[model samples]
Target: MALMITDECINCDVCEPECPNDAISMGAEIYVIDPGKCTECVGHFDEPQCIQVCPVECIPKNPEHLESPEQLMQKYHALVTAKNDA
Candidate 1:
């Protein structure tokens, strides 16, 4: 499943760099996760890298964009392929 940054985010700027998928970006108020690019670090790490570095624990699963592990792996492969092609 993709993860989201809640309103509780302190704008700490830590999670943005930790996201292996480059899904996290500075929003109007806080860091936001792009569900289309988020794979919960399935292709890179065992755990969500953003959650691991977020001090306030604001990152949580995105209910609206839920996907199974197999789906996540597919997405991860797509992302890698897209990057390689560029």
Candidate 2:
């Protein structure tokens, strides 16, 4: 599942660069995760780099966009498969 930034975030700008999918962005008051782009590091890393680097520990699973590991795998494949075919 894509990670969601909680309001507890201090906007410290730590997690933004850690995401391989470039899913994290600086919002007005907190960091935001783009669910459509977030593969939860399924195809990139063994773990979610953003969660690892976030000191605030405010990144949590996006309940609204909950997805399983296999779903994440499909998402990763769908994203790169098309580009590779190009």
* Number of the top-ranking candidate, with lDDT as the measure: 1
Tens digits of per-residue lDDT, candidate 1, 1-86, equal 88999999999888888888899999999889999999999989999988888888888899999899999999999999999999
Candidate 1: which stretches are off by over 4 Å?
Answer: none
RMSD of 1: 0.5
lDDT of 2 by residue, 1-86 (tens): 88899999988888998987778898877889999989999999999998999888998899899899999999989878866797
Among the numbered candidates, top TM-score falls to 1
Per-model RMSD to reference: 0.5, 1.6
- List candidate 2 stretches off by more than 4 Å: 82-86
- In model 1, the number of clashes is 0
